[model samples]
Target: MWIVLSLFTALCEAIKDGLCKKGLQGNNFLVIAWAWKAFSLPFLLPLSFITPVPEYLSLRFLGILALGGGLNILATILYIRAIQASDLSLTLPLLSFTPIFLLFTSPLMVGDKPEPTGFLGVFLIFLGSYILGSSKPGFWGPIKGLFSEKGPRLMLCVALIWSIAANVDKMGIRETSPFFWAFCVQAFIASGLTLLLFKQQKSISLGSRKNIFLLSLIGLFTAMGLISQMSAVNIGLVPYVIAIKRLSIVFGVIIGALVFKEKDLKLRLCGAMIMLAGVFLMTA
Candidate 1:
């Protein structure tokens, strides 16, 4: 059951991210962030009604949720910023490191010592994600860009913030319902804040009916991914679950190549296959 949920979660997240990249093509990052969360808020209403409100909510839990929420919002903003400022080649590789950071931090926070096999799996996942996210013209260029201070720092920040957010989220769920009421609450708050701050740009529109419709669909997929991911972590080991979830990077590469007509499809495909081998090891 957990395995099925995990696969579904990764699939949904990949689709969601693909849509996000599409929507960001010519749109305002802040508006995309706001609109996605706002659209997703209503879907959670049913979940909120069905799940009992957590009665044992602690200051600790609330703090973690708020921090996670803030980081999530930051991640969205920075991701869009990265996409706008840099190539998918540059941005996606930086984003791939989130799980690497999560793996290292998991021990300190959760004290879950992944087995040697688990570490091996994580190494494969990392190599796959990095290769899959890099450019073919010169994979070395993206590697150099990643280390340079000028390239996609915001994306790196997103990776670090989300690593912390993932851990805090795992902890918070232990105290609350797996139905993810905290996510619902945080999304609402974040959307409200986005709307307030970005009101001047309210008049900025997608200008294309198709893009608007597609963006909404992407937002829905993202909501589903978030809900499904919470479900996976609630049931499975955090690092293992997250390591498996990184398979989304492979999906993202395929989407970029096929849907977005990104160049170097052949090379990325090879990298993606390697990444899949990593995912298999992580789950082994």
Candidate 2:
């Protein structure tokens, strides 16, 4: 069940990315980022009222939510700037490091670790993702640039933050229901971004009917992805769940090929095959 939910979450994430790509033309980064959270409120806010609340809330839960939301906002901003700062081929490959970071953070923060086979699966997923993004400069160049370059360095920080944030999410979900926690975290993030936008004198106006509609779609998928992800993390191992979630990269490649007629399909397809093999090892 967790595996299925994780795949659904990956699908939702891939679709949201594609939609955001389409919507990114006229919109500023901050506004689109805000829309990713704000527009999801229509779907997410309702879940708060409908879902059963936890019997006992604790200070730890409140702290986890606050810390997780803050970390995520920072990660999101760094993520956006990383892409803007450097080439996609370089920065994106660094995202695979998240699972590796999780290997340490998981046991420390959440007191959980994957089996040896599952750990190997995580490593393979990282390798496959690196290959998927290693188009122009090849493997060594990107690997070498991980620290010296600004974008890769920023993305590495984002990965490290996400690794810790994942554990925080697991702790928060343990204290509250997944639905409620999802709503709370997202609401916090949306509110935080709203303030940041205001500080920058940026308006949240989506502008243009088509752009608005596209972002709405992004929001819808974002909500679905959030719910499914939190639910999966609640019951599944955090490292394994995150490893599966990175399947979004494979899905993104397929979507780009079929929908947008993007090139470089063969190389990425090979990488996807490697990722599937790793997932099999972990799930089997």
Candidate 3:
């Protein structure tokens, strides 16, 4: 069930990225980022009221939430910037490195350790990432190209930040229901982003009607994806859930190829398959 939920999260995440990329066509990236969280308020806020509250809210829980939300906001900003700056194909695959970072973060943040097989899964994911980035001249050529580009580097940072945030999320969920945690964290992020947006742009206008509509769609998918992800993490191991969720990279690559006509489809798809195999190993 958790696996199914995580898969749903992946689909919603991929769709959200596509929609966000579309919204970025005409709107400011910050506006799109702010809308990504703010618009989701309508869908997520209500969950706080109906979901069972935690028996007690510890200072520890609040602390984790604050820390996690801060990290998440930073990650969101970097992720939006990375996507806005680079092609979907180049940027999205680097996100596969998140689970690799999690091998270290999960243990330290949540006291969760991967099974022996999981380490092998992580190795496969690493190899797949190398394949995805590698091309032409030689094995090292693609790697050099990857570092030479800004998008992949920004995405790599996003992946590392997300690994920490994911463990913090698991910690928060252990103390409260997934829906409740999602509501609080998202509300915090939205509030912070709103302030940031207002600071940058005098007012928080939705701009043209088409952008409003596009942002609204992005928000809906974002809400669904986050809600599903929080639920899955609450019940499953963070690493396992994240590994599965990384399937979003595959979906993102395919969407990029079809919708955006991104280059290097064959290489990207091959990398995605290798990563998918790693995800399977982690699950097994």
Candidate 4:
């Protein structure tokens, strides 16, 4: 049942990522990220109320939350920037390196060590990501159909930050309700920092009524996916949960192909299988 819930959580995360990609086309990436968080308040605030937040947080827990919040914001900002600047196919596979980063750091943060199978799983995930993310060539390139140059090295930096943040979340989860507190802290901090760092311009407005509604809907999905992922970690192995959650890439590829009319469905499907196989190996 927990595994099923984790799968659903992955689906939500994928859907939200897809929506983010759709919404970000031709839009300011930072502004869209801010808008998504702003729109998140309505849904997330109510969740905080309904879910029963703890009256008093432990000092240790509070520190963990703060660290997680910082990392979350960094990861979120970098992710948006990376996605906007690079191809999803390229950026996402690189991002999949998060699990490998987590594997090494989990022990220091929370004293959890991977079994031999777990290490094998981690290797497979990276190998699959490498294959999937490698770029194809244009008519001018060497492959004429399979050669591609690397994207921003900065995105890899962001992926590293995201990896650390994910492991931090696992550490934070052991100390509190990962769903409620982590969301509250990260959302609050991210929103506040965004508002502070990016001065609101008079020219910047929410735009059309339809876009507002749509963006907010996407925000709600983001909140749901985040909370669900946190909840899944509360019950399952952190690394395993994350490994499985990355399967959302498969869902993203499918939605991109079917709904958004993206090209290269066959290649993406093949990548998805390799990814899933890697995930299974990681957990086995």
Candidate 5:
């Protein structure tokens, strides 16, 4: 059940990424990032009302929410700058490092210790993700770019922040219903990103040539993705859930080949097979 939810989350992630790519061109990353969560807020708000709210809110819950939200906001900014500063092949692959960081952070933060085999699966997912983006760099550039380039370093920080944030979210969910916590986290992130967006642009717009329906679709999928992810985290091991969610890279590859008519399917599908093996190890 959790695996199914995780896969759904990964699909939503890839869809949202594609939508954002289509709808958010030529906008400040802050505005685009704000739109990512902002539109999701409307969809999540109703869920919070229908779902039972916690009778008591704890300081620990608030602390975790703040920490997680802040990390994500910073991560969004750094991630944009990272991609802006370097080649896509150089920086994007570093995102797969999240699960590796999660292996340690998950146990330390949320006490999620998967079996030894799960660790191998996690490694393979990372390796597969690296392979997916290694087409232009031949692997050495991404490895060497970690220290030599600002983009890789920033992206690495984004991955690390995401690792910690995922665990913090798990802890936060334990304190409240998943629906309520999801809304809270979204609200918190939306608020923070809103301020940044306005400060950066002085005003927000839908961006040049962006379709309103397209932006809404991005938010809708993002809402579904987060809801699914939080639910998965509640019932499943963090490493397993995150490893499965990282299959978004695989989904992105297939989408690229099919929807965008991108090339290199042979290599990307090989990487996808490796990630599928990782998922099998995880769920089997």
Candidate 6:
């Protein structure tokens, strides 16, 4: 059941990415980011109140929420920049690095240890990334290209930030219901981004009815994805759940090829499959 939920989360996330990428054609990243969170409030805010809260909230929990929410805002903006600057296939695969980053972050943040199998999973994921970046003759070509590419480099930063935020999310969920934690963190992020959006543009504009509908769809899918993800993590191990959730990259690649008519479909699909295998291995 958790696996099913995680897969659904991945689907919603992939769809959201496609919608956001379309919306980015004429929209600013800040406004898109703000809308992503703000639109979700209509669904998440009411659900949060109905869900049972923790018996007591601690300063530690609040600190984690604030810190994680701030990092999320940064990561999200970088993510938007990445996709806008490059192909979805190129940017999304680098996110596979998140599990690798978690290898170091998990121990410190949540006192969790990766099993030996997880190390193997990490190696497979790295191999997939190498393939994704490969174009020239020698191994050094792909390795260098991975770092040299603007989109992939930004996504690497997103992966690192998410590794920390994932742990913080687990910590938050441990203290409260998943719905409540998601709502609070998203609200904080929305509030912060709203301020920045206004400061930069002075006013928000939905552009047209068509764009407004697309942006709303992005938020709706994002809200559903996060809710499903949080619910899965609440019951399952964070690393395992997140590893599966990263399957959204595979979905994203397919969506890119079909919707955006992205190039290099053959090689990208192969790399995405290899990465998906690694994600499966993480559950072992």
TM-score against native, each model: 0.88, 0.96, 0.89, 0.84, 0.96, 0.87
C-alpha local distance difference test of each model? 0.71, 0.88, 0.82, 0.67, 0.87, 0.79
- Tell me how candidate 3 scores on lDDT: 0.82
Backbone clash pairs for candidate 1 read none
**Model 3, C-alpha of 75: deviation from truth (Å):** 1.8
Per-candidate total of colliding backbone pairs: 0, 0, 0, 3, 0, 0
Estimate candidate 2's alpha-carbon lDDT, on a 0 to 1 scale: 0.88
lDDT of 2 by residue, 1-284 (tens): 99999999989999998888777778877788889998898899888888889777788888888999999999989988998888878998898889899989999988887999999899989888888888667767677887678998899899999999999998888888899999999999999989998888755565778888888898999999999999999999998888888999999998998888988878888888888888998899
What CA root-mean-square deviation does each model show from the true structure? 2.5, 1.3, 2.6, 3.9, 1.4, 2.8
Is candidate 2 or 6 superior in lDDT?
A: 2
Which candidate comes out best when scored by lDDT?
A: 2
Tens-digit lDDT string for candidate 6 (151-245): 77888899899989988888899888899999999998999888888888999999899998888888889889989989887776666667667
lDDT of 4 by residue, 1-284 (tens): 55676678789887877777777764567767776666666666666666655677788877877787777677666666666666655555566666777787767766667788877776666655555455353212222212342443446666677667666677676665665664666576666657645675534556778777768887788777777777777676666666677778778777877789977666556767777777677545
**What residue pairs clash in candidate 4, if any at all?**
121-282, 137-146, 137-147
- Candidate 4 TM-score over all chains jointly: 0.84
Ranking by lDDT: 2, 5, 3, 6, 1, 4
Q: Name the regions of candidate 1 deviating beyond 4 angstroms.
A: 147-149, 185-189, 192-196, 199-212
The C-alpha local distance difference test score for the whole of candidate 5 amounts to 0.87
lDDT digits (tens) for residues 1-284 of candidate 3: 88899889989988998898788778788888898988888888888889999778999889988998999899988888887787655676577678888989888878778899888877676667556655333445434536777877888899899999999988888888899999889988998898888888889777778878888898899899999999999888788788878777678778978899877768767878887788788788
User: What residue runs in model 6 are displaced by over 4 Å at the alpha carbon?
Assistant: 80-92, 129-142, 145-152
Better of 1 and 5 by TM-score: 5
lDDT tens string, model 5, 1-284? 89999999999999998777766465555666788988898888888888877888888888988898999888988988998899888998999999999999988888899898899999999889888987776767788998888999999999999999999889888888888899999999899988887787788777434466777887899999999999999999998898899899999997887787878778778888999999888877
User: Relative to the unseen true structure, what is the C-alpha lDDT of residue 127 in candidate 4, on a scale of 0 to 100?
Assistant: 56
Output the better candidate (3/5) by lDDT. 5
lDDT of 2 at 149: 84
